[model samples]
Target: MTNIEKKVIDVTGLSSDQIAMLEEIVAALKAVSQTNNYQGKVSLDRLEETPQPSLTLEQRRAFLQLTLEERRRLLAQQAENMVEHYQENTEWQEFLAGGIIEY
Candidate 1:
């Protein structure tokens, strides 16, 4: 028999339906992988283009002197900034309005 026929005979145990189902699964996995790869590439490009902040040693020291409440407030503000940076819907607005974030 031909090489193609030989290969097909080797897996003759799998019905035609099984082969088709396997192909469908493989195609779906490939599509998902391609999408994930594209997203990862875009994320990497964005990260590379984003500027890194530089802080002086004195500024870092002063930041460390903040009280726990002050630190929480600063962190919440930073979270808000990140949300705005990504243009994400604000889910923390209610929490902020509730005054759960101490200043």
Candidate 2:
């Protein structure tokens, strides 16, 4: 795999809540991925065995940094039953939590 360069995230424009939410999502995903109940494509054992190409902090933050309108779209797309679906869809949940709706 190709290596990705790391850079600092310019979070100056983000509100405290947004930053907190972004961090919260990443931590939640990682934590859930470690759980025995996790039913995602990638297992905890596999994760531990693999040298994954992790995203830079800036890249993760940038991926999650969405405009207000974008947030609205995500909400609309996932406002109801989607959360239930996300519980089983690890990748989509992570993407949604990162301000991306993979549809």
Candidate 3:
């Protein structure tokens, strides 16, 4: 078999959806390499219009009243959910926490 097929065979544990995403990335990279100027848009479509765990005024007040550790746990949970759904990492935890704390 060819090297590309062999490399693909070596990959493990990715779902079909993940593989599809990687293939799309590879195609985009190839396009950029060939043309030297990719016109592709970087989409924020993955970031929904509404934030997750949307809070009402009362809910926001209650969340603001939570102790720092409690707030951290909630942010961690949200980060975990994001990781599960979007392959996003926990690095976003601090950023989210900052937004909530500053509000």
Q: Model 1, poorest ten-residue lDDT window?
A: 1-10
**Tens digits of per-residue lDDT for model 2 on 1-103?**
1112333556698899777766664465455334423232354555532333455676456446766664565446434434544565567555567644546
How high a TM-score does candidate 2 get?
0.29
Candidate with top lDDT is 2
TM-score list, all predictions? 0.36, 0.29, 0.34
All models: lDDT? 0.44, 0.51, 0.44
Error of 3 at 82 (Å): 0.1
Which of candidates 1 and 2 is the stronger one according to TM-score?
1
Off by over 4 Å in 3: 1-53, 88-103
True-structure Cα RMSD, model 3: 17.9
Candidate 1: tens digits of C-alpha lDDT, residues 26-96: 35434543443322122444544323344445444545554466556656755554555445433345446
User: How far in Å is the alpha carbon of 13 misplaced in model 2?
Assistant: 0.7
Pitting candidate 2 against candidate 3, the one with the higher lDDT is 2
Q: Best TM-score goes to which candidate?
A: 1
lDDT of 3 by residue, 1-103 (tens): 0011112323377677555554554454344334422112123666433222333454455555544775676567545544453443343555666654554
Model 1 clashing residue pairs (backbone): none
Please give the lDDT score at residue 16 for candidate 2. Answer: 91
